[model samples]
Target: IEGGLLASPPPHQYEFARLNLTYVITSKRKLAQLVYDHKVNGWDDPRIPTIVGLRRRGYTPEALQLFAERIGVTKSDSWIDYSTLEGCLREDLELKAHRGMAVLNPVKLVMTNWDEVMGVGHLEPCSQPALPHAPHGASSDAAPEGTEPPPARHFTIGKEVWIDREDFEEVPPKGYKRLFPGNKVRLKGGYVIECTGCTKDANGLITEVLATVVPDTKSGTPGSETVKVKAAITWVGVANGVNAEVRLYDRLFLDAQPDAGGKDFIESLNPNSLKVITAKVEPSLANALPGQNFQFERHGYFVADRVDHVQGRNPVFNLAVGLKDSWGK
Candidate 1:
């Protein structure tokens, strides 16, 4: 009211709107506290609800727009569940993200029959769809429609490949489909193998799993289509794979309504929200540029860190979200 006329507002005022997302608070003071109190890594932590944080976590603009559309414009205060946002992200990424393999908490799998079949130290060539869901000419990496897709990106595999340590168990529960003594499984995009057994150190910790390749079971080979297996596991060849720092992010708060019921919101913090691991990733992943997104097949969606990733340097990847359903309420 500088000169008796309100300069910024219209003659008629509009009602205010409130956005209440579950498990998130839009309070600057509280967010600052989280940073200063060492409750979070920083303002850009993926667990935070700020726009900078969301961008760093690989949340796409399309997904945010979809979320806004689904929620519409609410007059009264409303709480939208976190899954609603995640669902939009999943939908957006399903068709846009490239697929790759990465193994966190890796365990060595040695091909006992490799030397006999492929010769000692031989590297076998393999390829995967660059972007299975991308439309014609949509990505710079994509081949033009109707053109023989450029020879699929090639990767090499030796006698050893790394698999997720959790993929095996001494005694599996009901319906377990991964590796175990005498069990058969397909090495995704590679070969079918039957577990011979595993070697353990003095501490009873498995050091290496031994498996024999089933002849003529290489995917895309003549007999591969006919040979069916209970499970197909992802692997990163020791000779061709690259090591990367991967950060797994989970829900920050354990409670659906952390600030509800007069409870201290900080008390609901999830202790295991971020876990860092040295992961074995496909050779191509080492070239992943900042902001590039990929689906770490069977694991989750991830992105090269915008600020930390550099070609030929140690690349950092952040788990955008898991392939599983919701992160609970």
Candidate 2:
């Protein structure tokens, strides 16, 4: 069989790190077999370890550069832990990606006193720094020194909102700081809310969490709030949150050294590599252009899918990397 290497990315200068670097070499024939057998979607499938796959999976150029710099060129063959690569992506994105809120597994959260505090059917406007790290001189993509701060993200908080399902529990654990009966937690960039009670479904699943919103605690946050809370929860306003598809991607291999010593790599393919979920995202994210990255606050860094994402409509995002490495632990 003549080598069908046409599917491979063209040879191009990576231009990373002033120092020389080496990268893993994957077999083009095997990759093509995986593609042809339909075990993997295509050359651009995020699970594939190729340039196109990485790009489609939301790996930024800066992140890849950092990865290359961290793992310098070695004369001898050696294996690198995958966490090293993931850490590089997180480190690079933390400095540049704008922050947004998205609830992957959402449950309803109702501000019972919202009408009494902020007026009926009213949505209070809220804002947060688009790039929170810009003030600390840590923003990698900040404008010139004399230029103004980056634009702030503007959203509104209504009577109802969507919170991650993990954020609430009827029975609090030893030291849970999130929503529980009589617990107070600040809604990051919004208000300090005190949990009153909850409404449960017929099967005892908590359908709605009820809370009382504190007044004068809209955006200036911890400074303007008289009530202090140990935990700050991320939430999206139900009135304006955009419903989007979020693809959670994990490592494709179960064994670190798959296909070594004549082993069949197919046996080690991870079954739970990608999971598609309907998520509620902030309104500002609806305007996100393709290829833009954002930190989903409590969630990890994600990027708008270049091919599938449609601004203000059907948004698609892929998890580039989690906030921290949690492999083999």
- Candidate 1 lDDT tens digits, 192-299: 998888899999999998999887888888879677788999999999789899999888888877776667889888998899989999978888888888899999
The C-alpha stretches of model 1 lying farther than 4 A from their native spots are 1-11, 136-151
Q: Which candidate is the best by lDDT?
A: 1
- Candidate 2 backbone clash number: 0
Residue-by-residue lDDT tens digits, candidate 2, 1-329: 24876555656664432321112226787778788998888889887778889888888788888887878875555677777877888888876788899999999999998999889999988888778776457464566568876688889999999999899988899989899989999898888899998998899988999999988876574556577788999999999999999999887778777766677878888888889999999988888999898999977999999889999888999998889877667
- Superposed on all Cα atoms, model 2 deviates from the true structure by an RMSD in Å of 7.3
* Candidate 1 displacement at residue 17 in angstroms: 3.5
Question: Least lDDT summed over 10 consecutive residues: which range in candidate 2?
Answer: 16-25
Candidate 2 positional error at 315, Å: 0.7
